[model samples]
Target: MDTSASSSQVAAAAVAVAMALLVPILSAAAGGDGWEDAHATFYGDETGGETMQGACGYGDLFQQGYGLETTALSVALFNEGWSCGGCYELLCHDSTYCAPGGATVRVTATNLCPANYSKPNENWCNPPLRHFDLSKPMFLRLVTDFRAGIIPVTYRRVPCAKRGGIRFEMKGNQWWVGVLVFNVAGAGDVKAMAVKGSQDGQWADMSRNWGQIWNGDKRHVGQGLSFRVVASDGRALVLDDVVPPAWAFGQSFEASGQF
Candidate 1:
């Protein structure tokens, strides 16, 4: 009956299934506790005027719009804007450079540093894999002296406690639909999203278009929108019928809970 070979095969299959389940759990744990020492530097003027738009597709820097007033991160930390909207708590460790109270500030990931794209010879934010190119205002807030060109800092990802609930911005028209998610709380950056139409039971995958914006080109205007969002830390939430049947273009919808 070849019982020994059959048992071995079954055992190997069990091990493979266990490993597959363990990978996601390990990844989530790593994402939650991943902290690193980094160097920080300031850019732009003290007033934050004349600041350029970031690679995350956010246009305004310090305005009333969403993602405004958020701090920009280095391109190294941006991870091609995948870290956009992710929140971090940073503290300056350099005694000489840090403020007297050792101030800690929470900042949202908004932009990417151009220096990361430069060649090794010309790279400004060089060597350090973890770096932060803070806005001039944010940088000054952490340092004792405004003249400190660089400061040693410790940073870790933290939950984003936005005032309101998670908001969804609607774009496109009756034929095509695009949705931009904002104000995510726990694990701010979305790893993936799926949308289900009220009439259809199937879930349609949404593609990422820089930062927190996700899009799906399905003619889903008439039906209500339900979203299943997966966070970077592997937390998933299904917000049933978040977008009501009477949704309009450019309108924002808020969900009660977050991932």
Candidate 2:
């Protein structure tokens, strides 16, 4: 009755299913552990090839929604006249995620709350809650009122770019800030990312992260960049340990010669 061949086929199918489940777990074990470095440029959309360069470690000032043409995010050691070679590479960016909604806005976060709720968890749709619902096409800057927890009052000057969202303004130079996203449920690949800057971005920091949405830490205490995740399940997304690392970079000239 060809029983042996049929049994072999069933075994093979079982093996395939096992392999599929094992792949994600194995990849997470190998890649999403500890602190890793990521590049400043990544695709902010689902096109898979559309790349967007990150702003300097300080912040990005966009004229509109579209992306910069060829301006790669500049990077160097935290020193005057520093170049890319032999630099410490402060932050490593994870290009794995751009926007939760797969939009053209690059990096985006969720609101993490129901419409009836008075306040949102965080602007990025990340809260300490176990479950959340996500609005599609999340943007990177859609942060929550986390200033009370992680940010100090001295650095609490929100940027105009923030508009109605959460954004920070760090006045000093040569400091680096970072943003990261993690898989809280440990279902998908988690990642941590950092962005470095020195002397107001004469030198630059990159981004970094883990495999899943877990806890994160940064050297800079001032306000940091933002990232987001979809809302679901009982697991929560936490952003913490945002610290500014000391750094220095070359000087710059103003058009008005104010200096």
**Which of the numbered candidates is closest to the native, going by highest TM-score?**
1
lDDT of 1 by residue, 1-259 (tens): 9999999999999999999977643443343346457878777786666454667655454431333246666656777778987888777764487886556777777777666455875554554457887777778778878798888877788887777667788876767678877777788888999999888767989999777677865568777999999889999999988998778887878888766
Tens-digit lDDT track for model 2 on 50-140? 2322222222213212222211211121111111001111111223332222122222211112122345544322222222111121222
lDDT of 2 at 214: 26
Give the Cα-based TM-score of candidate 2 against the true structure: 0.20
lDDT, residue 38, model 2: 25
Clashes of 1: 1
Task: Please give the lDDT score for candidate 1.
Answer: 0.74
**What local distance difference test score does each model get?**
0.74, 0.25
User: Which 10 consecutive residues of model 1 have the lowest summed lDDT?
Assistant: 60-69
TM-score per candidate: 0.74, 0.20
Distance (Å) between predicted and true CA of 8, model 2?
3.4
Locate the minimum summed-lDDT window of 10 residues in model 2.
Answer: 151-160
How much does each candidate deviate from the true structure in C-alpha RMSD?
13.4, 18.9
